[model samples]
Target chain A: MFPPRSQRILLAVLAASALLSAVSGRLNPYFLDVALGAGISVVLASSLNLINGFTGQFSLGHAGFMAVGAYASAMLTTTLAPRLGLSANLLQWVFFPLSLVAGGLLAALAGVAVGAPSLRLKGDYLAIVTLGFGEIIKVVLQNVDAVGASRGLTGIPSHTNFFWVFGSAAVTVYVVWALLNSTYGRGFLAVADDEVAAEAMGLNTTGYKITAFVVGAFFAGVAGGLYAHLKGYLNPGGFSFDKSIEIVVMVILGGMGRHSGVVVAALLLTVLTESLRQTGAFRMIVYSVLLIVLMLTRPQGLFVWPLWSKKEGRP
Target chain B: MNRSVSGPRSRRSFLTLAACSAVLAGCREKDGDTGAQAIRLGLFGALSGSEAGLGQYTDMGATLALEEVNAAGGVLGRRLEMVREDNRTMAGESATAVKKLLSRDQVVAVIGDGNSGRCLEAGPLCQAAGVPMVSPAATNPKVTEIGDCIFRVCFTDPFQGAVMARFARETLHLSKVGLLVDASAPYSLGLASVFRERFAAEGGTVVSEQRFSGGDKDFRAQLTALKSAGIEAVFAPSYYHSGGLILRQARDLGFDGPMLGSDGWEAPELLEVAGRTAEGSYFPVHFSPENTDPLVAGFLDRFRRRFGKPPTGVSALAFDTLQLIADALRRAGSAEPPAIRAALASTREFQGITGRISMDSGRNARKPAVIIGVRDGAFRFLRVVDPGDPGRASS
Candidate 1:
């Protein structure tokens, strides 16, 4: 059980994010870019942790939900926001945040569409279904001329600063933490532990799985919206199967079910990537080697054991 | 289950926060010192990803120009310093790279984003900062439309597509053509669409249009579809990797008329992979090393002497782009970005290795496209087709 201090934690996170965003203008732009990248990774990995780590569902289409959110928010902010008759200052606060929320809602809808049928299947079958869904989203985005087709959507006003990115990240962490600690959230653990037994106990395992998928996908969409504004452009290729694998890797490397461990892993991996920029052409080779060594050494997750007290009746 | 209250958990969280700040502090230490009097010029590209060749070639070309300019008393009495960043070929990475070049490195002008997708990501930032960005070979028309500060030395897709269509219709005398487009690439699709419309407008019929994704090795199926459609020539708008295989496969199918392609088909692999079957294939190229122009000869010699390898068309365009920047810098008489942009926009009849270049109203180079014919595993120059007179392609 979590302490009755969720409201205080939320306020602290918001204050810290706003303070960082205020002074971030004076930071080295390269460091700021890398930090923003790390914040986005934390959002993505934590949301994915909800499904794969806590709910025991192997959903591989996080990037698809992300692309849906990115494009939706990109279109809203770029095309629809200009027509809303709001002043520039009002548009920044109103249209931008609303568009991000709209993007998250649309991605949640996509999550329901994917989870309703696929939740019946388990393990590799669910993984395959989600993988196919991700590909389908990419190909559809590639062909839809309304969204610029293969040329990609550009001219998205850059609305994502440190406050927006880290603020969303903090909110994501709080929501996932708060939800998982609630009594109703115990069904997710039961389903993840033993699906048949959870159903035998009348726990409605499918409903729990669907809930995890919807919440995880909503955050992933917000992450995508932040990403589109960060880069000011969206190419379908950017949300390919490779991107999905990246988020999955972060989750697995972070000790899946643990939120704090996932955040550290996301930040470490992001910093590692930016540091390897000095290695020139061999950076990828070195990066893969480091990952292989990490996996070989810390199979249970990098920041798992000894960092937290061992739970009862668990390894 | 005894749930211990959080003592170590808070410590671990504090450690994570400390590690994050340490990383940020370490990044701050890397703020390098540039030469006091050097005019820094930046280039960002996919130097370490699948598209690494584009970046490497651009760097070599730009460095050669930098050497020559510095040797000739430099521009504005200051040596031109080349600062390059690897974008890793991703759009998001490219934005960060461009931002670093602008804010961290403080380069006066940015150059050499060979891929259009990456350039689009970098273009808006450069435009917003009032910094001139001269792309060497990103041929998408939308690149320059970002703003007046964005310029490209290479011809756009529409120009090359129109040139190939005219060549197929007038020179090759082909009325019915079949198209094999690479659907995965925007370049291929853009070129294919333009060629389709222009060929039709030229009174030539597009008999069949088939699609294949990039990295698909076999094209016999699409070639068969086109061959059976009773087409006189095959128009495969793709890069040299698949372009070569398409040519060889069409020949194997005994349907060799004259294969017409765009500038994407200019790599040496087109002749090597297609082998003897590559003969009679024509493609529009930015530069042909076989040209007898003194500018072309001088560029080839200098590039070979420095990089110790023959230059590709991409390198030639990159060489022209950097030289154009240096020319603009000298003409502007100041190293300021806005002045350089103004000077670049006013460029007219500046002879580059590729050809005489002039910046049009759109900040695109208004230059001729060179047509190259393949014969015996070598690229041969055919004619120069100017934009004004598409019909007058004189050798």
Candidate 2:
């Protein structure tokens, strides 16, 4: 197995090279575009795993965070990037990272606000709350006139590249992985395993749960920001309930607690969805069948084993 | 006992090996690339979801165009290849499809994003990457406003709104109008704005304006408000799916007033959805494809032969847009973005199934809008409004 640090560094280098190649027009623009999409999905799926897998929260409002990120990043880049009068090269470097962070921060704030009340609930109630939150975000966004409301925000400078997308995904994975391996991560797992026991253990269960929720939302928001720039447009429809479910599906299918599982699932699912398009009208039916079959055959998911599985009987 | 243990162990190993071989074989077969040399054009639409009919019809239209273009030695001696991607009516998926089309397929251009919101999301990426996109049916002005690289064949909401307004004032001779709009839809909101602005300008009063969401099935509250306002004509600018439900519900609620809408009511399903209530409703469309013009007749004949049904307004617009792109390519003599944009901007008097096509300063098609009224469960052409007489009363 590769060292975690070196694996991350290697991934970063590969992503940087891809971005450079794309901007220089040396790489196939189409492949670069697909890479960017896969990268964004990786960010979304992995972040959502933190809440659904590690914290054992059943939130389905991933798209709400994405919307927050998209709108926030769009407003920042469009409103602030121009005033700064930064050179094109500098703007490319600075605004991309700034938008990602802004998106994450705004999403985190939204997560905290939503999670404060909903986190206290359990099972279907929490799911309903998160689903409702996602719908509310879409509805509120549809009416906010400053960002063009239902008409959507246009004329966003297209600065999202392969590097920006994969780099952010890498950072999200690293952060989430590191957090999962630390005391906070243990607290999250404990809450997931048994909330009552976790609280009995003197752990601030609510605090840990909320932290995971916020962090997960933050990464989702960052992915949304990357998506907005990559598409060069922002619309509420992009962050609808259907989108939230897609991310959740990714996390579940990748095996909730497994990091590489999420990554592989994101890539495989993305490719499968695209390939299924060639099957004409029956594609969706076939996809649904496949999902059902997979569930029945492999209930624990394809990659159920966590990369850093604790030594047997140690816990 | 030892022999028995060896036999069981060998059987287990054999099964595992067979499963591995099966997986490997499946992967290899699926990974094979059937290489074809053609200019791959990506088509994104809600192909397999709630809006499957819309996407299927669009695919048919695009396929017809692609087949015809290829039959004629293709564009620039290369066959036109269509790489279809289903958005499932989700904007995020649409964006992802756009990326895949641009990066993986290396498509020359993209066509047929039926929904306005999806187009709005995907248009910018195309513009940024300098890949020309021609949306056949996305009518919201915001889609093209993204950049110069984006072009749409269909008229914007402003044009359709004016058409509906003219029909209401002149053809229907209704001075008092009620606007029942889907506030959640960019298309509906835009049309409502323009229709209200132009109707009032033409010495008509928008007596009542009621709002509803896209998924709203019941407009009883809004209709009740309109009924109290004593409006003679109702303008409901929304997609046929929702418009049919509203019309059916309104008729059930004793609304007998003439209803007017934009091209969103151009689906055949409208008749089935609204039943007899949809009759007498007027809507403006880009084309009917039922015209007697030889070129249009030829297209309709070919479309019927291929798809076994009459094409809707969207299908015609999509077909025309593809043709327009081909025409522009011929005129520009190159597939480069700047050349094509310049060629597209200078387009004038180009005969399209819709009408004599031209471009205004806003890069919108400057073609005449055709008003079609539902008569006997079929679209009957009422009149065609020219761009010259913007204020000509239909009567």
Candidate 3:
């Protein structure tokens, strides 16, 4: 099922460089813009899928973590890229992905801080907490000086394009999907099924829960970093509860806990939002109407995938 | 406009009017399938959302300008066709909309992004594409700093802040000042920063300062602090919604100081919310309908006939922006983007409905601001200030 390790690395390099070269040409800005948006959505949905779908954390503050990651990454690139004084070519190759990593790691840390307290809560209560946390993040960013306050940090080098977004998306899917297949991944499923039973079975449910949040936070951070660079702009207004709800819709519209389904849903919704530009004033209204129809028809999502290839429900 | 006094009109002017209308009809019909001979322009704004009003007014201004151009036998024998895009008032979304205009619709010159945030977002994209974009009312200084291809027709924040500061210090002749700034708003903060700097530079003392966030209903605490400071006047650079509430609260605390504000106090809600408390408030603005200049009156009548209402400051600036673009196109003698950019940069003493606009090196418009006073439930034009030159503070 797997290619040889050296060959896989060589293929990945070839694909990335090819994408870069293609984008360097007069790639249709219209299609590239919509496709880049779709790629970011894919990352966000899949990351949120980890906590809400696989581990059953049901986070409503995914946008807050995204904001943190975006601001952190934006600050790094805008500040450090200039100070490095390197050639433009070297800067793009070296510092671009480094900022994303920096953003993701910071978001993972934020997950630990917030998840440590609120993980004890369940269901709707947890949702409410996460929602509040999201608003708090926006407010804090607005008041902070380093991030340009409410004006938001502009002049961010527009580095996000097809290669970085799709590559990061691929990495997010592989890491999450691979994690879900490990022995520790079984603990996550057990916790989601029943906490009491999983605890009685000697599973460290709390540890697994935190792991899910950190992992989810990491990819969401990556998504935020890409988003910050894609628009070459960042604003707290873009990361409100509306953003969180939009991501949740993408997750639920696909099958919960289904990675491939989430990717498809993200692509569909992103492209739809862009393609409906011709609808004028009724574009968003039409988007909502279509989504409602989809929900009413296929409530469990378009793709329903079993987590494991087994007949039994749980361990 | 010149009809004969007698029952039988003169034939010469009648023929001219008929020719004008026919040319206008031709311009309006140029959007037909041929698609070859017309110059394509683009317009983008908050076409739908909470701020849709601004976008609608922008469209109206451009529509009027286009009608004038088309009526005058079109531009270089090519009728101007606008490819309008609704930016939806988001930074990334506006960029995407402009990108579509650049790639798909392929507009030569773009105008719009009435607000600063979206202008800042879309400016660099236009620069990269070598398209000229002129913002009608983006007052933020950073909008033009993106590149040479980006420009705006409104006075930047620093100029606006200094205008208000000078008015509060020289025009109103007040020395001791109290400042109230909204910490959460970029406009308010930028305005407050400059007002503070220039107020100090102008040798006026700022006795006390207070801060509040947007949507905070209660301002008694900040008012009490400013009132107790015994300042002569209060400068509250905030939105009308919050400004109205703050005025009410300040009065309840018995601070009768002269309350000054920026264009954020443009809405009518300040009167409804603050009631009689809103009287005597002073603020700097882009346009006032009460001006008696012939240019102002002429445009006012045309705007009324077209949009069914007097143009607000936002719309007036937008109208001037389009006229300014048309002026540049006429001078450049070509539809090329780079040539248009050069022509726009060299514009000086261009008679817009608002005022004469000249471009600075930063691509920001060097223009004067009008400070108006609220008296007897109406806006009274008070004084005009040009902050770039202190000698021309009032003209």
Candidate 4:
């Protein structure tokens, strides 16, 4: 067997190869687009996992962060694109990176504001507060006249591509992965294990929890920003509670806090949902049934086997 | 416990490796192009969920049009293949669907995004990819306003709103109107704005304006307020999902005022949901089912035979959009996006089931609007309002 470091290098090389193949232009751009969407979902699901999985705080307002990111990035790009007066190709190269970071920062700010108030509560109360916050964001976005209000913000120059989406996803995965391995990550796990013990250990449980929440929000915001550029339109309805739930589902089905699990879930759910289009009204019924059954049988998720499991006899 | 921690980390690394391999496989599959014979045209709309009926109708409409075109020896002697995707009434999914159609399926064109918001989301992706897309029923002007590549067959909210507003004033003699709009819906909010502007400009008073979200079933509070406003007419610009519920609740609450709405309320399910309450409710539709024009008659027969129901305005619009696209492709003699867009723009006097369509500078169809009312459990045609007048009263 390869050493751990060699395995990591091999994985990175494989990922790069896969991404290059996606960008090779000979393949249909549509699949590349789907891959891009999967990438964005990775960012959203993994970020959400930080709060809902590791920190043991449930949030259904990830879409709100997405909205903040989308609008902020769109406005920035719109302003900078004209002033910079770069060619479309060059402009895309410069603006996409900047917009993504801007989106993440804005989302992190929103996360702090929402997390500070709601993290004080527990379980269902946090859920309700977060849900309400999501709705409030939608309403606020709808009423903002400068961003086109209910009519929606259109004419956004499309700068998002396969490279940008996948690159962001890689960054999101790396950051979250690094965070999960650090001391702060242990604080998060401690809180998830038992809040009282974590607090007793002088972990500043509130601060660590809020940090996880903010980090998750930041990535969701980045995803949203990428989404806006990809679609070239932004509307309040695009970032509702349903959207938040979708990200949550990805994390849950992928085995929360498990990086590979989330990635698998995002791709599977997207394709499964799309493929079931022919089922008409029964599609959601089937989806609900599948989810329920999965929950009942394997609550630990399809990917319960961790990456480094030492169970010698297991598959 | 320490083992558990290490276990997850190592497992995560392994899983990442596996994910990377899977993605690599996906990329390889993308590179190996199968030289597909036919020109793939994508059909995307709400195919499931709450708006499945709309999606079904749109698919039927597009399919029929494709059938007719194929019967006429196909476009440019190459058979047109439709790659369909269901948006499921969600904007995010709609964007994803469009991307799949454009990038994966390699469709030259796309059609059928019934919801305004979905169309709005899909429009940019099409523009970016230089894919020509013509939505059959998405009437929000913002869809086309995204870029030159995005176009629609139906008239916009402004035109439909003006038509309904004029119908309320001239036909129903409703001078004082109450507005009950879905605040959460872009279509409703947009239609309401135009309706208010046109209604007030045409010597009509909007006595009160009330709001409800898209999924709100109980509209009694808003209806009660509108009722107390002493309005002769109520303009509820919303989809059939909430529109039917509102109309039923309003009738049950004994507020029997004439309800006026734009094209959003032109679904047959409105009658099913609102039942007897749907009677006397007027809406501006792009096409009336009562039209005896030979082309419309043929369309109705085919549609009824296929779907086992009479075609609604949405289906007709979808049908017209497909035909329009086929017509443009024929005229352009190529499926290239830019050529198709130019052909679409220059299209004039093109015989469509709705009317003789001529593309304006904005690429919107210049067609007459029809006012239809529900009577005897069916849509009864009132009259066709001519273009260029905005349905306003002449001095």
Candidate 5:
């Protein structure tokens, strides 16, 4: 069971988010857009946290899985939803979530296909493989005429709103938190700490690693679906290796396996990036400097070690 | 197991979440006051990417136009202010730039995004916000198709491609050609496909076709392949950076045949990169500096006096685009976006430095493309290819 106070906090956060979503139409469109972006970042960073943080797998191709999900779901919404002959509300409310689930399933399958063999390699080798895989997906998407190739897939339905984005973020956070806390999830920690010892102790290390990849990739796919719908456009360049690096930075900056820390980092990074846009041409320079300062000052992740030192029994 | 739920750490995490929300809310202050005296316009482009050279050209052109307008008594008796954002030629950045321009800067009009893909990315956002966007040189046919509020000052790829194809087949009298297409750029892809189709229709044979990604410096492999095919000309539809490299590489590979290009090759950096090897290569542009028209001579004189160099085709397009917007504001007699949109929609026979520009039904500029050939490290006027004029070129 989860902690009672944490549950209260989660409930309170969810209620407030829902209330805000209800009145989102009245809010400034710019802030609403930023909030939706932050929500997607939360989903991506949290799911990435499950693999790279707790499971100790370095995946530089999370964006590849996201691309698979984005393209798969986008194909359905743009190509299939119209043929269903459903009404507007029916298509959005009923068919949209189905498309997202289908997209996530495809991404999970891709994860298994990629992770089954590649997960055997650890650390830097695994990172290189994932990075290559991300590029492969981008190049393949670029040549696929059905998805518009390098010209990019446009006219995607704009069904992603505050409710869908935040609701998915909440679900992603809960799944990642609950799955890691349960007894069955201890195998993941063992694998992360020392794969050889866990294997000697009769733990299915490969299974845990594959499971982490599958689940992580699944949520990443869902996040991609949300992203495709939010922007109403999808391009291979949107899910390039640079995109995967962005998610990794979020997970690392949030302190690996700490769920709350990752969440906070995602929110702050998205907000900081948007706010820095007002600085004109030096926006990116200012953002990089702030990130460097944060990393140097708090190398253990922005908000993790200080608060959880006592709970995790660290010095 | 630790049983405490309300530990100080958990409370702190909760406070962090609250603080995050507070920051988001605090940044939600009302939009900038529009009651100011200046009529603001938004300009955005790839200011720091592989296409940064083109960005510089556009920025310089817009600045010159801004200064000229202000010097000639401001628009509607109010100073015209331009707010610029750099998209960095990256995906999704254009949408964010457009959002900031529309919501925060509250500009009456937006003019920018010379590349088609970036223009498409920002088109829908401007349409939804009821703001008009004028692109200087995004040549894709699909750009203005996004919505009513989206417009461009350049000819579409379909027209540009056909013009190039006809020029290569008829003017050059070349029966065989090689194709070098930029696979990554929508602008290049669109132009390449149309050229392929149109060239075949013109009874010209494409002996070989090769592809290279945008920003690729090593074009020897592709260029060597095209040279071996023994084609008379190579049509490399790419931006200046890659186009210039292709031209130099083709010459180095001993392909003396002319390398035909689209408007994407109009930047001065092409001459800088290709040097003397760029001679005999030809490309279609919005306007040629070699025009004998007094209006063009006057514009070039002022541009040279200001920038100490000849303005590229994009800079000219940018200058005309901003002038078009200012003209709309003057005609509308108001700084409101809808009124400006209407004035822009009614643009007719507007005399520009490029040529006479009229907004067609599709919101595209109905104008001719000027073919400029590089001779002795200078761009010289070749011929004017009117729309649907076939091969009749009046030199």
Candidate 6:
């Protein structure tokens, strides 16, 4: 958790982010477009960062949890909102949060289900399992009629705006960052530092690993809920393997264990992606060239070069 | 609930922030029109990516119509301007592109979306923004069902299937048929089901039915089964890529009946893959370049002169879509979004490059579908299937 003084500033930053977002969203949809996209990316990266960075679990199923959360929450809102007999405003302001939380909880259970088997496996093996899980989820979703099958589910209320998106982003960051300051977070760090040492120290490494995995999945689910409502449409293709890899890139390029690094990286990638579409035919060409140049210039990450690096032996 | 109350100070600020944002939203609820002189129309589609091979035709067609409309003294006494954006053939990108077009470009009408999924993503926003969007080639039934503001230049999916079944049963005199459906594709599956139902109702027997996923290139087994059944024709409701492979495979297996398909075979690569075997194949297209109609000929001439090649069916549909928008604008007599939508809805007997197009209340175009056959490495005109052709027998 942030110190008391730092917490106040963090709270202020959150407040200002919301205020700026609202103003931009209202003034013109273009700014809202950037903010909304960046905000979702922030949530997704921050959640995945909890697992892949702090816990050192190489989970590639971030987008799968996101899809599950998105489809579930979207299904609830689209089907129940009208039948709940609540006004549209009330449905969004009140019931939507309930659906988002429910979606997150379900995603957490899925994370547990996938984690229980593969957490004991080593790095690349875990990555393959998680990657496989992602593809399986996408394949399963494609065949499910309840979610509109391959055609995708439409008529999802556009309940997501800057406030909801940035609000969820703030909440995701706060919860994950706060966990890093908790004893459970220390267990996660111990496991990442050395699983053998963590086990010898009676830290229950597997339990700690599961906690991080569940927390990561929960936030990813929340991100999915925001995404579905924002896009007002959800296709299995939207949450493909490429999407899962995208979040992993943010976590890696942001730095392994730095919150601000992940935040900056997510915003950069999302805004860069949407803005670069203006390049027309060359957007894809520019995207790969930019990534290659960045990789060559700073292999550690875009922002992980100095600010958050550990300086040892300073005393 | 108590925990959510974080602290008195933070809670107060949160409330203040929400109130402020609400006020701001109210302030900008109704944006003031800048009242630009030019009537801005928007076009969005896959200008790049896998589908771009086909979608590029759509881009040219819309751009050509924009040029033609502006050259003929514009719409509503204003030079019609097109603000085109590339959707990149992705789902979320289409929604983003439409949002930008509606807000940033402030386009009153959008003509776009050669693909159905992309159109579905963009349709909701156009409906919400009170802007009209006409999809040039999206054939899914759910697209127009999104809202009244969303319309399409092409016929709906089921109608396309029925058109093919009629062309096969009545025109080609095929009594039995086999279906090689791609179960993974929504477009393929939808057309397959409709064709099956319509063909069965026509007293035509489906002696053989085989299934294949979209990416499956090998269909020797399915082709072998079709050979055994001795069906008169095979209806392959697949895109050009798979359609070409299926036809080539079928020919290799020595099943030489008339291979029927839908507009999914509009791509030039279909002929390239199947080669000489692609000739004598049939499919229903919205517009055929071989049409001797004056309007169709003029479009083909202009298209060939501009792009150095004749326009494909998608291109022709896109050109007609833009012209339809221009026609609606002329009839509405204003650049107002609502009036343009009304004009688009009440569109009747719109004689364009495609054909005479009328809109049902569902925003679907009621028009004749042209059945095209391949011969000598080019699409040749077969016959026009009228919209209300009777003798639709029950199964």
Give the best candidate by lDDT: 1
Could you give candidate 4's per-residue lDDT for residues B61-111 as a string of tens digits? 888888888888889888888878876677667777787777767788889
Against the native chain B, each candidate's TM-score is 0.82, 0.74, 0.83, 0.77, 0.72, 0.79
Q: For candidate 1, lDDT tens digit of each residue in A8-64?
A: 666777788889888988987778888888889889999999999888899899999
Residues A131-170 of candidate 5 have per-residue lDDT tens digits of 9988999999988888988778888888887777877887
Query: Model-by-model lDDT, in order?
Result: 0.85, 0.77, 0.80, 0.78, 0.83, 0.81
Please state the error at residue A101 of candidate 6 in Å: 1.1
Report the lDDT of model 3 for residue B215: 77
**Worst 10 contiguous positions by lDDT, candidate 2 chain A:** A306-315
Which sections of candidate 3 miss by over 4 Å?
A1-24, A304-315, B1-34, B165-259, B292-311, B378-395
Relative to the unseen true structure, what is the C-alpha lDDT of residue A300 in candidate 3, on a scale of 0 to 100? 66
Best candidate, DockQ: 4
**Each prediction's TM-score against the native?**
0.85, 0.78, 0.83, 0.79, 0.84, 0.82
Q: Mind giving the per-residue lDDT tens digits that candidate 2 earns over B1-395?
A: 11111123333233224322432332332333335556667788888677777887888878888788889998776666788888787666777778767766667678858777788778867877788888887776666777777777777777777777767887778899999989877678877887887888878999999999888888889998998899997899999998898888878889888888778788888888998999878888777665666887888999999889988767888788778877887788776666777788788878888887876666677777888888898888777776344322210
Candidates in order: C-alpha RMSD to true structure: 4.9, 7.5, 13.9, 5.9, 5.1, 6.1
Per-candidate DockQ versus the true complex?
0.31, 0.18, 0.11, 0.34, 0.27, 0.26
Better structure of 1 and 5 per lDDT:
1
Give the winner by TM-score: 1 or 4: 1
| Model 4 DockQ class | acceptable
CAPRI class assigned to model 6? acceptable
lDDT of 2 by residue, A100-165 (tens): 798899999999999988788988999999999999999898888888887678777778876677
Going through the candidates in order, state the TM-score of chain A alone for each one.
Answer: 0.96, 0.90, 0.92, 0.90, 0.94, 0.93
Interface RMSD of 4: 3.5
Candidate 4 residues lying further than 4 Å off, grouped into runs, are A1-27, A84-95, A161-167, A200-203, A267-298, A311-315, B4-16, B28-39, B71-78, B128-130, B161-261, B264-282, B292-298, B332-339, B374-379, B388-395
Put the candidates in lDDT order, highest first: 1, 5, 6, 3, 4, 2
- Candidate 4 whole-model C-alpha lDDT, 0 to 1: 0.78
